[model samples]
Target: MQNSTCHLQPSLATSVALPVIYSLLFPAGSFGNILAAWIFLKQAPTKRTQYIYLGNLVAANLCVCSTMPFLAVYFARGYQWTYVSTECKITNHLGTLNMHVSMYVTIIILCSTAINQYATLKKTSDTQYSQAINENFYRCVLKKFRQPKFAKQLSTIIWLTVLCITVIAIIYNAKEEIEKDSKCYSIGAEANETTAGIAAFVGTACFFLSFTTVLLSYYCLTKHLSKIQKTTCIGEKHLIYSTVKRNILVIQMILTVCFLPYHIFRPIFYVLLTDRYCLRLNYLVEIKNFLTCLAAAKSSLDPIIILMLDKTFKKSLYGLFTKSTPENHQCKADIFTEETSKM
Candidate 1:
């Protein structure tokens, strides 16, 4: 009998590793996000801006997770296009939409949080200002949509924007053969170098700008609170400031550590890797693949970060999964509520 052992291409080796990791990750991410959305939905019945932002994020995560099965299959088949033509078309569109939507949604989330932080500091120098500001913002934006005046016009505009962008990206990807079987196919080389440069610049600007805004907001809030004469908010302000800062920092840390390497520096390495694609740069390709995978893995870890940051999520988890029956449920809720308040 022939020997079973054989060396594998870097791409094949990466493919071999994908399904095993993604199979575990996809379900966990899906379930956690579903659970978080359910809890958040139950708490606030109003359609507020924060709710809209978070709802979109949850929906984005769901869309991405839904694509994982097809992606898993792709890796399982060693990147072969095995689906029917129609199925291929659907998968291609869905996958591209999910990837782009997920990235932009994350950027928007970071930007929204930073803006909220700045607004909170500016309005009343109080964290509770978020509730009113967010509610008012949503009411203002959505009230027009509900009116009989131009509802259909606005709806059509929204849909048209989404449709145009989706179609353009699909066409761009198709023309570029971006999904071709290659060691670097997953990073999504743009249809043109100028387009890629623009995307990289925009994405990098949003990433750093959001991060710096959050950091500066935290510093200003701390400084303002220190100089304030009011003693009523001494304890409450400290608690809220500390908790929100920690939460933002956690997200910033993940984005900085996970994405910075792959998205920012990969172009420099990409040029070098191209010089010796056949033999010498194989190791570089392996590192690139691993970093890209790490970037994807951050999406899975986001829900866990939320849970760590929000005591409400932990309470819901304990209620749903633990032995907190009717007898102890009230106690559990109280405990978690107190923890959240302290946070």
Candidate 2:
């Protein structure tokens, strides 16, 4: 017996909606990430731990931006592409790979930053960075993560691990072959239906791991900040810690708005997209695809987060537009340096 493939009929609404969604997403994501990348590269290398992760996050965003056009075109053509062709494989692979990689990498980076922020802020008014927090072994362990060297190492490891897993997953979960009655761009190949079940479970687990970690990080950090703010008078140090605390919240917001829905839908999509419901719920394919598109929207959103977290980048951005004198810029730079050193 030959293998059966997914043959869900692509609907006009989905066909129209995808291209429209991705059309807007492609240019916006690409332009935003490119501008962010330009600003990042122009700045001098620093010992800041946060910049390293932010840079890596920008790279991941660019990867998502780079793949958007091909995806837009694929959807614009109403899923007419053949599964057997190299273009299809490449587009599908890069699109899905970038989406998953970008989300997980963003998740890991945010989690790390959250932990680092907590570690930095957990110190008493007069205590050294680790001395106050050392009572909690976890906070003590974050010492390395606060360093630039550790950030670089962690960024490299995250990218390599995510890429390797994504490659393996694409190879195993998708076998894009067309038979006489099979459809090319359905949810997945019908013969390998079990793969979706496994992938859904795995994906959801990873998602919750990220979600919980970031959630707890936000809660703990905010709680600590509230205590400090209540007792301390208004000052630059309070401002610094408060900024750090707000950034953690920003990362948490990004995680919730972008990645949460995709994870929530995956298990349901997998279960319902089986033989029992696949043909009946043809539109489910597009709904899943749209959510995937929404996950990728973070590529555009990340640059704003970068600006929120990194004052240096923000200054440089403003300086470009405002035409400040050299001495003025230098003074601002010095002030920034002083503030950064205090952290």
Candidate 3:
């Protein structure tokens, strides 16, 4: 099976559309991630460890975006990869790595934030049940893991673990034989049914895990916030409540827009392709390709989300673009610094 070749031809419309989409995404994603990186770097020293994870997320997005031009050219050339086999392998590997990294990192950020918020709320609760066994259990669990240092360590561990698993997959795929006449265009062509099946299984697991984590985190957060609102006067903490709500909403939007479609479609696409059912459903291939491109576009879209949701980032961006007096610039910088410090 590893010696066999799989020739999957994308539809003409899809072939044309993919390159155009990739072409547009390349510059937009690159610019946004670069700007995000610059902002994160400037604020890194004063920022919490959450910013460390965010900085890593921006870096991963940049890595994903960097491969877009090559993909564009590949699709533009009628699904033919003009590059050497090694380059083809590297490009494919990078895409897979970035996909997993981006999804998992986003999960980590959301889960950590949810946990911290829950811990903070619980610690300040005046309810009689605050001293109950369940409350103590949560306090103990959260106390063990809820710290900036722990977040930093977890981020490092996630990066290393993802790198290791992806590297193994890359090596396995690289060992597969390629036909001399075939272009390195179809990812399914690089591996056999067994490998593709395993990949599909892993992807399915990841999708469920990520989706469930995000959903539960947001649900718990919303529930907790509702309780707080019921107990406390809305006018007293309106700014903080609104800001937190906006951030959560932005996260849900990002998860829905950028990640959800790909996660939902990818496993099905892979299963069909591996089982040879996709030949009868050629449109699925096109949809899969479109989802792949869309997933990559998420990295680009994230910075825009951050800019819209984060006042500090928005202010810094505005100050950068607009001509301002040194005094005004200094004031904005101070504000930015203060905001990041609180983050």
Task: TM-score each candidate.
Answer: 0.67, 0.87, 0.82
lDDT tens string, model 3, 1-343? 4223445677776668777887888799899989989977774343454466567777767767776776665566535652246656555666544555555555555555545544434444434565563457655665544466776777688778777877787787677665655666654443346776676577667656755665665676678778877887657445655565566566666667766787788767655654554454456666766777776787778788778866776777777777879897678768867654444
Which stretch of 10 consecutive residues in model 3 shows the poorest summed lDDT? 117-126
Runs in model 1 lying further than 4 Å from the true structure = 1-12, 45-50, 78-92, 121-164, 175-198, 225-233, 269-276, 280-286, 316-343
Q: Candidate 2, residues 264-342: lDDT per residue as tens digits?
A: 8777766665445545666666777778788888888777777777777887777768867889668766856765575
Most lDDT-accurate candidate: 2
Report the lDDT of model 2 for residue 42.
71
Evaluate all candidate structures by whole-model CA lDDT and list the values in order.
0.54, 0.70, 0.64
- Candidate 1, residues 1-343, lDDT tens digits: the string is 0111111244655567776776777898788778777876664222333334445556656666776665565455533442234445555567534554465556556545444443433444544555664578643443343232333343344345556766776776566543233322222321133545455566567667766765665676556666663545555556666665565566567667877776666566445533423443545555755665666666677677767866655666667666756767677657655543342
User: Which prediction has more favorable lDDT, 1 or 3?
Assistant: 3
Q: Is candidate 1 or candidate 3 better by TM-score?
A: 3
Ranking by lDDT: 2, 3, 1
Model 3 residue 78 CA deviation (Å) reads 6.2
Candidate order by TM-score, decreasing, is 2, 3, 1
Clashes of each: 0, 0, 0
* Lowest-sum lDDT 10-residue window in model 2: 175-184
